[model samples]
Target: MKTNPPAVQIVAISADEAGQRIDNFLRTQLKGVPKSMIYRILRKGEVRVNKKRIKPEYKLVAGDEIRIPPVRVAERDEQTVSPKLAKVASLADAILYEDDWILVMNKPSGTAVHGGSGLSFGVIEGLRALRPEARFLELVHRLDRDTSGVLLVAKKRSALRSLHEQLREKGMQKDYLALVRGSWPSHLKVVQAPLLKNILQSGERVVRVNSEGKPSETRFKVEERYAHATLVKASPVTGRTHQIRVHTLHAGHPIAFDDRYGEQEFDRQLATTGLNRLFLHAAALTFTHPNSGEVMRMEAPLDERLKQCLKVLRQQAQ
Candidate 1:
């Protein structure tokens, strides 16, 4: 029913493949191989770039040769539409903006941007399935699985490069609405801290403020103050993994229902009020269009669930 592929194969990186992480490239190249196997091969130096061992995080460059050692791979099942992805297929209706070179959508919460880590499929996979005619589509940026908001996708390589430049230059602006656990100080507006990332023995990632860390900054402005929670608009000046969550924790006001960086007791109390998910949302994004060079601003309204939670909180305060 299954047969091993060639014992070994060499691949030359193409311009479109350049800048992609080696691990992802392996996943695509070695279809049907488990992710663990891919990582194991990398650890054992079984995979090489230009005849030298490279780590999983290595970014491929155009014309670089990759040496892949063949291992038995199970025959992949025929592609079928995942029932769970049926909803993902509907993301086309949520399009906020689209053009020849760019696409934007109001990504729903509880949906991963891409499929991995036990997920069968995600937004990107779903979109690809829905638009079979699209030749090139790639996420320009990422949002957490549980964060709802405006998401940008590039439809061309040149657009992706230009937008990445904007992000690196900090010219792209993102605003988020978050409900924090405590009353935020009116005078406390700016948070400048250094964040360090740590991977626990269990493979869980965590970010915290540490002296020996990368410089990070976030600007907070109170939008609404509740009895036990405060609604704030957060603008991160430096993009880092979990920068907003870590910075909020550093300010002694972790976001409400933020299981990772929040206080369990506080979260439990809020959980009793029908709030089941984190209350952080990507409210808006502003950037210069990569193709047109015109300034563009996109906004995603708070989802009904988040809006209902705020309504309940305000009613209680009244």
Candidate 2:
């Protein structure tokens, strides 16, 4: 049976909890509560800060008193990852770096960053299950499920804020490696295009290059050329949904094995070389440590499958 709080509860914000948005804070406080219900209460003035209604985006400050109305919460069994599961268990070895404030993982391909949209669990969930004692863990940013490589997770709200600030200000650097069809022209180093996200009737999301879309830019540098493909380093100057994939497609070259925005023929050709997944990888990341104020650069080595594919491509080139 479910139960509702008998009376309104008031919470006093602390210094460590400050800087989070009101809606986000509510999420942590009211576990098992639906987001729609939370917003509904906020809209109806059922929730208040210092006896005054506040918007969902309001940043919590230390010493603010929040009034939460009584609400019924649905109870469900918590999701847990089995420690014996090879894939989830192997994540412990994928850690590239970890500190008190953050964790950097060499995320494997085909693993979603978070669970949703039919997935029961993902990397974050698996991590939580593995480290049952950690109080807080959240993704600082996201990567496509099929894209493998450097991923960051924040252990504290303050660290998340600091890392997000770096991302917003373009102070952090993200470098990706992609194998694309055909020889990439050396002169075509930069792709600047606007990208518009669209949802089909089937609910599948796709990004296209459109004038009315958000501004996006990707800088590409040829790393090595194969007989039928080119390995390039891609640096996204602006982050947008599928920016790199869309930009490469706009430039007449698409990533190999990218079913969404890639060349099918190119993918078919590479399949013979054992390349069955998307050929894009988040090769490296450079960012300032949230707590130490030190610049950190981390790199992830290509998995064996990717390395084998590259070897085949090199042989074909020769």
Candidate 3:
């Protein structure tokens, strides 16, 4: 017979916890609780801030008091990452830079930024498992599971808030390297399109260019030219979901090996060239340091597999 935990008392929001949404904060406080239950409580006014009903999206402010309702939660064993697990352990070597404020790593392709969506664990979880002593560790931004490179993690709540603000204010500069089908016209430097995200009945997410979508823009520059493909540098001005992938697709040249918005023939051709993964990499990131206020730039080199693919493409072109 499992017993529910004692009722939670009013929690005063600290400066470190400020700026986070009520729903997200609740998720952290009420660990293992289902998101549906959290929303239900909020909708029914069972959860309140300063005795006032608040929406899930309401951001917490310093000095605010929050009241969390008691809820039944199943007692489940915490998922632990075995040190012998090669993939999770390899993250130690993937780290490009780390300090008291933030940590930057060259994330491997096929690895999700954080665990969810049927995945047991991901970069954030693995990191937390690795550093049990660290009090705060959170993702400042996210990268697609298939996209690799330059992923940032904040070690402090203040750093996370600052970095998020930079992203919102367009102060962060993110650059990607993508190998696309066909020759990218030099004159076509930018693609300004609106993107709408749609969830299929099967629960897969897809983004498309539509009039009803949010405005998006991606700047492109031809980096190298191959026989039937082109390597382009992509800088997304807007952080829309699948902005780069859909923008390149809208430009009539989808990325190589992109399972979702790519051409089957292009993937088949690249398959022979040793390109088995999406040809999109977060090559570089530039932003101001949250603590020091100094400009920081980091670059990640393409993986060996991607480099070998490029070598094969070059040989064929020659």
Lowest lDDT sum, 10 consecutive residues, model 2, at 75-84
TM-score for predicted model 3 compared with the true structure: 0.74
- What value does the lDDT take at residue 203 in candidate 2? 75
Each model's TM-score? 0.73, 0.73, 0.74
Tens digits of per-residue lDDT for model 2 on 1-318? 965457999999999999998988997888876554566688678999999988777899999999999887534322342333446556766878766799899999999999887888799997886556568999999999999999999999999999999999999999999999998999999999999999999878899999999988999999999988899999998989888988888898899988899988888888768988998999999999999899999999999999999999888878
- Badly placed stretches (over 4 Å) of model 2 are 1-84
Off by over 4 Å in 1: 1-82
> On residues 26-121, what C-alpha lDDT tens digit does candidate 1 reach at each position?
989988665545766886798999999987678999999999998764343313535654465457556677677888899998889998878877
User: All candidates: CA RMSD in angstroms?
Assistant: 14.2, 13.2, 13.6
TM-score of 1: 0.73
Better of 1 and 3 by lDDT: 3
List residue ranges in candidate 3 displaced over 4 A. Answer: 1-84
Worst 10 residues of 3 by lDDT: 75-84
How are the candidates ranked when ordered by lDDT, highest leading? 3, 2, 1
Q: What does candidate 2 score on TM?
A: 0.73
Model 1, CA-based lDDT: 0.85
lDDT tens digits, residue span 73-187, model 3:
5444223434334465577668787778998999999989877789887999978865665799999988999999999999999999999999999999999999999999999
**After aligning candidate 2 to the native by TM-score, how far in Å is the CA of 248 from where it should be?**
0.7
